[model samples]
Target: SVEELRKLLSDKDAYENYLHSIEEVKQLDTLRNDLRKRNVTLARHNLGKESEMAELRNQCMIIRTTELATAQEKFLDAQRREKEILARSSPASILNKLQEAANAADDESESLHRKLLSGELKVPEFLQKYRQQRVLYHRRTLLRLAA
Candidate 1:
């Protein structure tokens, strides 16, 4: 009988301490569940963002391979064309062309005179065309000399 009575009187604050502990444990469990839900939501959002980033990276690679490569090739072709044009536009080449043009103009005037004498060309037409060809020859000669 005395053992039972001593157990009943063992610590007057035990009941109050147990109740407080239970409340604290309930609050902690609720907080843990809320944190778990938040973590799941954040993980899903992170996964979505990572997938979007990967897709964007893939598109960039496609553009780099196709569009950028095409543009680079076009640029190279343009550079080659420019080099060819520059080569053909050298001073010596320009001077030679002017001399050839003068010769051609002189030959054309001679042909017109021959045609006039042969009666293949009318007098007024022959005069006009011959004068134009002679003027062109003189102009080409002047240009060739200047060059």
Candidate 2:
């Protein structure tokens, strides 16, 4: 009877772990969807602002402000992903690795932005207004380099 009880408890633990993994995947999916929606909204806003540039002499300044806001939003999205990965990580050490990866991505994106702003790199008009795209590009480049 004791052996049977131990087996039952082990099975329960395994079942619970499986459920947790499923939940984590769902959470990650939700975060991805939300991030995509935010990106689309940012693009639409920037396009609309650019379309009115002839009438609004302040379009360039507005684009810069919007670009900053979009970058901040992308940063927040990465933060959320970092948190989710941390939560999903097992043995706990994986959380640190995931967080480090996210932070490194953020750092690379910031460096690119600084270079663009300092005129070290020439950024086209569309890129100047779309900071999230720049962040994504930088983040992917960093990840690839790390890999």
Candidate 3:
């Protein structure tokens, strides 16, 4: 009787356990696939955001560079006008002094021009320095706009 009862119980328990194992494996496989799909989607979203951010950063730099260039150009124009006034101030009869000052300005301007043309100075920094120098010239001299 004991042996018969043991055989029946074992038969019932084995089949039920095997069925449960099969169901659990199927559920696990489905969960794995779902997680993988979500991971792929998240990765794509993050990459898109990164590229957009990079594009926006580049645009911002371009705008800032353009604004700085504009400010520098205005300052240089003012300086040139002031220099012209200074040149005109020397008595018309004293051409020699005016010529000498003009020559010096030309030499310094040429040196800076060469550096700019050669790409030795970063454009934005060069422009900023030029603006500062122009401001200094304005403050120091009796120069005024010529026209």
Top model number, lDDT: 1
- Per TM-score, the best of the predicted structures is 1
**How many pairs of residues in model 2 come into backbone collision?**
0
Which pairs of residues have clashing backbones in candidate 3?
A: none
All models: lDDT?
0.89, 0.72, 0.71
Task: State residue 139's C-alpha deviation in candidate 3, in Å.
Answer: 34
Clashing pairs in 2: none
Off by over 4 Å in 2: 1-90, 125-147
Candidate 2, run of 10 with poorest lDDT: 90-99
**Candidate 1 lDDT tens digits, 3-99:** 7556547865764455457877879878999999999999999998998999999999998899989999999999999999988899888988889
Candidate 1 positional error at 11, Å: 18
lDDT score for candidate 3 against the true structure = 0.71
Q: Which is the winner by lDDT between candidate 1 and candidate 3?
A: 1
Q: In model 1, which runs have C-alpha deviations exceeding 4 angstroms?
A: 1-29, 44-56, 63-97, 116-128
TM-score for all predictions?
0.50, 0.26, 0.32
- lDDT by residue (tens digit), candidate 3, 1-147: 777566657899865565557977779878999999999999999998998999999999999999999999999999999988887676652455544555555555556667888998777876776566545544333232231
As a whole number from 0 to 100, the lDDT of residue 97 in candidate 3 is 51
Candidate 3: stretches off by over 4 Å: 1-46, 91-147
